[model samples]
Target: MIKYIGSKRALLPWITGTIQSIHHQVPIRTVVDLFSGSARVGHALKAKGFYVISNDLMTYAYILAQALVEADARTYSQERVQPILDRLQSLPPRQGWFTQDYCEKARYFQPKNGARIEAIREGLETEAGGDPLLRAILLTSLMLAADRVDSTTGIQMAYLKRWAPRAHNDLHLDYPPLLNGPGQALQGDALEVAAHLEADLFYLDPPYNQHSYLGNYHVWETLVRWDKPQTYGVANKRKDVQERKSPFNSKREAREAMQTLLGRIQAQHLVVSFNNEGFFAAEEIEEMLRHWGFVRRLTRPHARYVGARIGIYNPRGEKVGRVSHTENHEYLFVATHSRRVYNALSDHTEALQLSLF
Candidate 1:
């Protein structure tokens, strides 16, 4: 998986444990990840044998879901994927849009790697005959490989002036571990998607602040779209970045957006992941979720993302000495309509505490 801000990679165990605890009470056969950013959580759920519907508004994220969640395990065997990798590795270097912008201008990757990226992307589209699933898997491989060698601090908001050590490495791809089950990937607004979809469980992990994923990861979006978009600013971000704002990014609109989303979700169990730094306080979230059913709150201490760990840097990539908090409190709110389900969670909580002690 690519390095992502606010990714649930470290919290996977806790999240899965919470889901399993609820599953012991109410059978969770289907799960809908309303804001499946990188599809990490949805992929994990699929691997656990739950049918998952992964939804995200970003094209890169949708591709990730298609590769890891929707693509069956048997479809991407080593024999099938290795030849593609070899072809990509053998591609002749061409200085196209990627090499000119990301490599020469922005310094996100070396020119060699940038040329490889461009060649591979073109190959995936033309050679694969634009087959969406196959393209998704191949794109995911390129995305992850690019992530490993990117010069930025786990974000594409800006590139380092000098190339990072990893930027020197050659681009390579490996087969993604695809889950063996029925899954679907969708690209649309979370609120609209939640209204039409019904599942045994709904996982809400919307953007918590004004930093939209589109703006932060514009490079990946451009790569996925391959639009040769008109770019602006020092980061060379796509122009559409301003147009793709979400209501959840506004302080005034976030509460209402969440309220509307929660109201429309039709599910037996609702599990929401939020951070203390979000616009709405924990109490406000609990109150909103309580309207649906009994709400149980779980908290965990987490380290902040890479950029936050270092002192703040302005758009010019200069550290301004304004440091953000190193630690964050992650809150998981579980809402259930059945009293039996609530009691089951309570018993599981007690057992977990006893075992910990």
Candidate 2:
């Protein structure tokens, strides 16, 4: 999987455990991942035998969800993946749009790797035989392969001026771990999707602050969209980056947005993931969730994302300063209409020595 900011990879154990605890009280047959960035949680849920509906507003995220959560294990066999890899490796080093901007100008990837990225992306669509799922798997492979050798400090907002060591490696593709189950991938406004979609549980993990995922991972978006969009600034970000904003990124609007989303979602149980650095305070989140159902909060001390630990760097790739905080408080709020489910989650938290309030 690609390295993503605010990814729940580190917190998966606790999250899955919490969900299992709730399942003990009330079976969660279907789950809707309202903001399935990277589809990490949704993939886990699918693996646990739940019919997962993963939704995200970003094209790249939708591709990820389709490849990992929606595609079944039997979809990608060696016969399917080997030929694509061979084709990618055999592609001539052509200076395409990806190379001109991201490689030669922005320096996000080495020229050699960028050329391969361009070649693979151009060839993937045709090779997939008009199957969206197959295209997703191929695109995901390219994205992950490019990310592994990217020179940035784990984000595309900016790139390291000097190539990182990993940038020297050749790009390669691997089969993404696809779960065996029925699942769906959606790309649109989560708020709008919530109104019509019904599920046994809804997992909400909206953007925490002003940092938008579109801005953070623009390269992937452009690659997946294959729009050859006009770009600007030192980062060579897509021109429409500014237009792709989420209300959850605004301090003034985040609370209201969350409240509106919670009110609209048709689900029996809600599991929300937010951190201490979010726009809303923990108490504010608890208060908002309480209106819909009985809410129980769980907190765990977590190491911040890898990018956070690498100190700060300007867009020009100059070292700026150090980050003060080395750790973050991750909050998992479980809101359920059932008292039994709430009590089970409460007991589960107590057993794990996690703080509950």
Candidate 3:
């Protein structure tokens, strides 16, 4: 998986274990992940025998979910995918929007890699034809490959002053660890989806702050969309970043948004993950969730993203600001009508042990 800032990679075991512990009380057959950013949580749940419905607004995120969550590996076997990836890897370098913007204007990837990315993306559009699954798998492979060679601190918001060591490495595409199951990857607003969708368990992990995922991963967005959009700024972000805003990103609006979303969601159970740096205080989230029945809270302290630890730097690459506290708490709120489900989550020993990571 890609190195995402708010990724549930470290918390996967804990999250999955907490859900599994509830099996004795209420069997969870289907799970709906509202903000399936990177599809990490959805994919993990799917592997554990739950039918996952992963939804995200971003095109890149939808593509990722389609490849990992929806598309079954048993159908798109490695034996078949490896040969396709090998051919894509050997495509002749061709300069395009990605090369001109992200490579030359900004230094996200080396020009050589950027050209290859452009070529492979274009090649796949023709090669995959009308096959959504094939298109998703190919794009997922390309996106992960680009992520490995990106010269940034795990985001597309800005590039490092000097190219990172990994930037020099040759770009290579690998088959994503796709799980075998029946799942759906949707592209739309979480609120819109919650209005119509019903599930056994709903996982909500909305954006905590002003930073938008589309802005942070704009390069990937452009790659997956393949719609050479109008870009601006040093990082070459899509113009749509300024236009497409989430209510959850607003401090004043987040509280109301969360409350409304909680009310709109039709689920027997809900598990929400929010960062300490988020708009709502831990108590505020607890208060909102309490209306649903019984709410159990689990807190885990973890290091902040690498960029925050790097401190603030000027345009000239000089460190100008001191770093604040280097860690934050991830609060997991579990709300369910079943007392047994609440009790199970409260005493999920395996989950607590997994959180030690």
Candidate 4:
């Protein structure tokens, strides 16, 4: 499934390599995805038999972790879970704010069937908030279903300016599915999430922009939470905390935040994923590790789909432009724990002084 923002589809290759690099020295049984959006890294780790802990500040992401990554497939008796999705597909539309269906982010999906999505979302909340797995499954199905009915091409909601796509008539969840792993999903800050769980490796994919996740997919998540607060605009827009922001997303404070996060890390091997857009540079992460006394560093370069056709960041269609796609250009830094290496590395290295990682 295509996540709204900060997808890991492109980074799996690098992640796998990084994990394997540490595996030879020590078995990686536990994996923590600190800013677990879409739970892609956590899911991959789970599939590979690593215990996963998925954490995100957004409630929808927590639900995603419960439904798609952590739920034991066996816990689902077809009798219980099957009926939920079954009812979802057949449930008629309702007249709530979201029931009117407006293109959420992509300017995708005109309104006709988007209402069905709103109804399904509310229905699931009313029905399964207590049953984490069931609620998550139903919520995920709803998000996917909403995307199918929307008018945009990808997850961005700016709307397709040239020509809108047709909404799909038939969409349903595929259940009796296997979502097995030993994991827990927490909805909170990235740093706090780390304080609670320490795994063999911690994979951090935080919000690299100043924009909040709540503001980006507020409609979908609001419906998932089922509060349906005051909405605005030609399309239904949920009320959001305009000032709500992540430390990693801000321009002025991202550096200090990164510094705090790196220092507090308990995991032996750290793997951080970020493109050129984040507040800190690639060298900044490496320098942080080195200062913490890390020796070896491994960097990888790969192609990324920035904005040729996706990852739209602006409101007007005019804002679309080329994003950096360095051929074999992405970077992942891995460091091993060695007391000698730690002692050898300077508390004051000139290379570590640079803030551009």
Candidate 5:
């Protein structure tokens, strides 16, 4: 998947280790992804047999997560889905909501492709009506389908002047295996939501720096949820909700939210993910976690580019363009109320790597 943001999958092995260290004896009881952007973390946890709760402010995020985490996995033989996609491709263009949606400057999806997508969307909606689980199954397929034609590497924010090999050639989308619906999606503040959840261990990967997720990929939310309301800003992006502010985005508020959140968690262990780009210093986060009885463990993984743009160009007409990936590394912070857990983390700088020993 061309993820709109970085995926936690890259650090799963290490995160699992940190979780083992903190709650070695107790069962997961519950795992909460308070900012479940795409629910990657929550899905990973569920696949490992843990009960997962996912939350996100964006309705689209909620929709995507709901399908990925809590919904029952559906098995559609390739024969069953291939015809549907073919029928979708054969559908005629219409001045429907989809055309308007894709034609938006923010969406940047071509009218021809958008019409096919509209057919798929309508087909899925019609097929899944009245059943939440089935709705999620079809939705997961739709999201992947939408990604297939996206002009940007991943997001529609910046289109490349050309396309990469995979994107340029032909996009043949295979439906993602359905997992579950957005797990307990909440359209409120993450800090507020995190405070109320009780779990054995809580993993926090709140937004970092000034990049507003909605600003970059608002269309995905629109695609999955598709309210298609009046929008504003650079590319007619949806201006549906009031923005949520936290210390993570603006350094000024980052501390206050961190303080409030760190003070509220009742979990025995807390693992926070951040990077050097964060305005709050490592020492400050350590101090906050320490005050809450969570000794902090810091791990720095090798930084790599994850957010890449994929597109293709035609001989003359405008086509998809080059790939642009973001350059960044991950920082894992483990905090535990147990001194034994803290000592384990404090004693080893190699805690960042995934070594099952």
Candidate 6:
């Protein structure tokens, strides 16, 4: 998977353990990930023998879920997919719109690698044909390849003024570590999905702050959509970034949206992850969830993302502001109607090995 802002990679053990503990008390066969950003949590749950239904509003996120969560590795094994990858890799790099926009205009990637990205992406449209899963796998490969060579602090909001050492390396695609299972991926609003999708457990990881994922990852959006959309600003963000706003991104509307979404979700159990920097406080979220059942909260302190640690930088790449704080609190809330489920989580809390505060 590509580098993501709230990937939940470090916290996977705790997330999975909580679900497994709940499963120990009551069977949880199916889990619905309402915001499967990188599909890391969904993929982990699937690997633990849970049928996962992963949904996200972003097309690239949907693709990640398709490749990692929905597509069964037994059906689309590395052996079966490598031949197509080989063909894509052998294609001669061609300079095109991707080169002009991302390379020449914004400098997200080097011109050389950007040309390869264009060629491979264009070739994927033909090679993957009509198979959506195959298309997702190819896109995943291309996206990961691009990520390795991107000259940024793990975001597309801006590129490094000077090329990072990794930017000089040749772009290479490797097969993603897909698991053997059956799952589903949907692209839509979370509230809408929660209204209809019923499952044993529902995981909510909504946008916590004003920073939009689409704005941070506009390049990936364009790469997967292949829309060649009109862009603006020094970052060359898709114009839609301004137009496509989520209620969760609004301080005024976030609370109401969360309340409505919490009311609509139809699940036996719910696990939610929220940042301390988010619009709502942890106590406020607990209060909202208590309407459903008993809620238990766990807190983990971790370092902030690299971009925040690097402080504020101008377009010239000079640091212009002091770093406020380099750490963050990620709060996980588990809510269920059953008292036994809550006890099971509380009992297993010690075993989670996450230094919860």
The candidate that achieves the highest TM-score relative to the unseen native structure: 6
TM-score to native of every candidate shown = 0.96, 0.96, 0.97, 0.82, 0.80, 0.98
The per-model lDDT (C-alpha) reads 0.87, 0.86, 0.89, 0.64, 0.64, 0.91
Question: Which residue pairs in candidate 1 have backbone atoms (N, alpha carbon, C) closer than 3 angstroms, thus clashing?
Answer: none
Q: Which ten residues in a row have the lowest lDDT in candidate 1?
A: 348-357
Tens-place lDDT digits, model 6, residues 242-334: 999999999999999999999998888999999789999999999999887689998878788898898878988788979999999888899
lDDT digits (tens) for residues 159-190 of candidate 2: 87678999999988776677666689998999
Off by over 4 Å in 2: 315-318, 353-357
Model 3 agreement with the true structure over 1-357: per-residue lDDT tens digits: 887998989888778877787765788898999999999999999999999999999999999999999999888889988888988889999998779999999999999999999889888977787889989999999989999999988887899999999999989999888888679999999988889898999999999999999999998899888888999887889999999999999988888888889999998899999978999889989999988899988888888889989986666899987998899998888899998787777568545766576
Candidate 1's TM-score reads 0.96
TM-score, model 4 to reference = 0.82
Off by over 4 Å in 1: 314-317, 350-357
Provide the lDDT at 291 for model 3: 83
Which pairs of residues have clashing backbones in candidate 6? none
Off by over 4 Å in 6: 354-357
Which lDDT value does model 3 have at 17?
79
Per-residue C-alpha lDDT of model 4 across residues 1-357, encoded as one tens digit per residue: 544556767667557645754664567887778888777777777777778888888887887888767787667656667777887767786645554445343344555465566566667766675877777877776776665655554444345565444464544555624465456777788776666677778877767768666766665667567775666553345556454667877878888887788777788777777766666677776777686456444444444433344544454556555654534345555555755433333332223323223
> What order do you get sorting by TM-score, best first?
6, 3, 1, 2, 4, 5
